[model samples]
Target: MTFGGLPTRWEPPGASRGVALVAPGRSYPPTAPLLDFTRVALLQHGFTVQQIWWDSLTRGEEEPEAWVRRHVAAAHAREDADRVLVVGKSLGTLAAPYAAERGLDAIWLTPLLTDPSVAEAVGANAGRQLLVGGLADALWDASVARELEEGGCQVLAVPDADHGMGTRGAVRTAEIHLEVARAVEAFLAGAAAGAGA
Candidate 1:
């Protein structure tokens, strides 16, 4: 699918209760297991998944948040969606403010917690959110994650995992991917329930 002329991949399920938008990292493709896991979890939770594919955004020559915001706005307009859940990876975490400002639920994997703007967004967001980061990842900040949790954001911290949440090899990587998937499913379920509150 295409949103605002940007290449996008959509996993739309019948009778979906909501929409899920995934913004992947500069290096990670939408098909990455972490993202794929998100897709599966959203589908299982009755949410459609709309993923923005790489184009110029993959170059990293320019900042991604602007492009992210634009694509999100376009996707929302195109889908005419009322309930949206934004999910992001490393560089994609820059979209936290857009999600926050819009009051949309979100899942941030390996977020760039070191950035004050990102921290501030998660801190001030009023909508349901899940934050996952790793201690091994330089971009991950334990204090910030704890602060977001204190502010009502659900958080998951993986030990010995890097920015991609990889434990080292394929075996361990797949294992962590499973863990993240299960966590996301639970998070989505909780967020869905919270929307009714």
Candidate 2:
């Protein structure tokens, strides 16, 4: 799909309660194995995945916040989408919440939250959102994680791994898949249930 002059890939349509928007990292394509693995994981947990590639942002070329608004509008067009969830890895995380600000829920993976000025551009309450990352991720620090939590997001720290959580290749493990699936299921269900409260 083309949104705001950018290209995005949508997963083959499947059974899902909502639409999931995944923004991939700079070093890899949307179809990279790690992203593919994560996409499948989200599918196994009943999410239909759509990916937006913003690799240019890392090179100081693209404006992620602007891209985010376009994709969020795209997700909103999906039938029966009461809520859209924006999920991102690394640089994409900086943009994901920008969409969330427009009323979609967002999930950040090994995110690096930049200055408040940028965060404010995303939305007033944008920083107060869910974030997930591995404990061993070098891209993030504890203080940043705490700031996100303080802003009101529920942060889930994956143990013993880096940004993509490949410690011993957990991506291929049935146990790890189950764990991630459960966490996502619970998080979405809870978020849905709490939408008005």
Candidate 3:
């Protein structure tokens, strides 16, 4: 996916105090049919999701930073989204921190790298971050996870799961989404309350 491009699909929720940006992994289409499940889950949880422009065949063309910023801006403009949250899968996870830098809370699911360098580059400093992954995910290591946590971010590790959290089997499907929604909701609630106080 290139920067300055548009999301292939945009799903709005019944009501939202914030916006959630969704980024798909490499080689995945923005309109991938399977994403219907994810979209449904987010909507069910009362989130307004700004979709990604995923292009699987457009190999190595992803400009992560620019794409993330553009979508966030567009979503805010369109919905008057007061709070922004990021949800990224695989390569998308790499972009989540970028959103966080611009005042959004983030959730990175199965990022491909455990590189703290990446975290530094994105300015994921001392707060406003969340990372979720399975123990089987080679992209992220314990050290990297620890680095994020030490930086004041929240982290969740799934047992026996892989990069996508789908490699394990059916049992993880609802569990992963549920965990993601719950975490994000809690973060949003806390952030909102903090701001109001």
Candidate 4:
């Protein structure tokens, strides 16, 4: 499948409640553990998942914000759903501004909190937003995450986890993954309930 004219991997469930757009990082593709598991979680939550494949060789040269705006806008134009959720990670977190501007629900994995604009966007979003990041990630700022949480965003700050949310041992890494997955599921459930209300 193709989304916003970019190659994509589409997974549509039998009865979808909405659409979930999965945007990957600069080096991390959708097939990565974090993103792939996110796709599975969204599917389990009855969302049609569209995992966009970025052409880093070409589109990566464009400004981060601009690239996200163009592709996400195209996705919105093509998708016909009452609800839309954006699941982004790292470079993909640039979509924060666009998602905020459009009032879309989002789950940001390892978001680039180092970018003031991205942090501001997350804080400004009135719609449901889930931010998951690790304390050990250079781009993850604990203070910023706390501020966003105070502003009503759901946050999962993992201690000792890296940019990939991986901890020291294999067992710990798996535990972190489970924790993240549970957070995503709970967040989506709340969003769904809020929408129905």
Candidate with the greatest TM-score versus the true structure: 4
Q: Where in model 2 is the C-alpha error above 4 Å?
A: 1-17, 32-47, 54-60, 63-80, 114-128, 168-181, 192-197
At residue 48, candidate 3 shows an lDDT of: 71
The residue pairs that clash in candidate 4, if any, are none
Better of 1 and 4 by lDDT: 4
TM-score rank, highest first? Answer: 4, 1, 3, 2
Clashes of 2: 0
Task: Estimate, for each residue in 129-189, the C-alpha lDDT of model 2 and write its tens digit.
Answer: 5666666777656566676677677777666656665476655444544555555556665
Clashes of each: 0, 0, 1, 0
* Residue pairs in candidate 3 whose N, alpha carbon or C atoms collide under 3 angstroms: 27-56
Task: Compute each candidate's TM-score over C-alphas.
Answer: 0.89, 0.63, 0.69, 0.92
lDDT of 4 by residue, 53-160 (tens): 776667747787899778777877789888889999998899999999989899999999999999999998888899999999999999999999999999999998
What tens-digit string does per-residue lDDT give for candidate 1 at 1-197? Answer: 67567545555567878788888887886778888878877887888788876565355655667877776677677675678888888877888999888888889999999999889998888888889878899999999899889889888898878888987699988887787887898897787676678
TM-score of 2: 0.63
The order by descending lDDT is 4, 1, 3, 2
Task: Evaluate residue 53 in candidate 1 and report its C-alpha lDDT on the 0 to 100 scale.
Answer: 66
Alpha-carbon shift of residue 193 in model 3 (angstroms): 4.7
Please tell me which model should have the higher TM-score, number 1 or number 4: 4
Q: Indicate whether candidate 2 or candidate 3 has the larger TM-score.
A: 3
lDDT of 2: 0.60
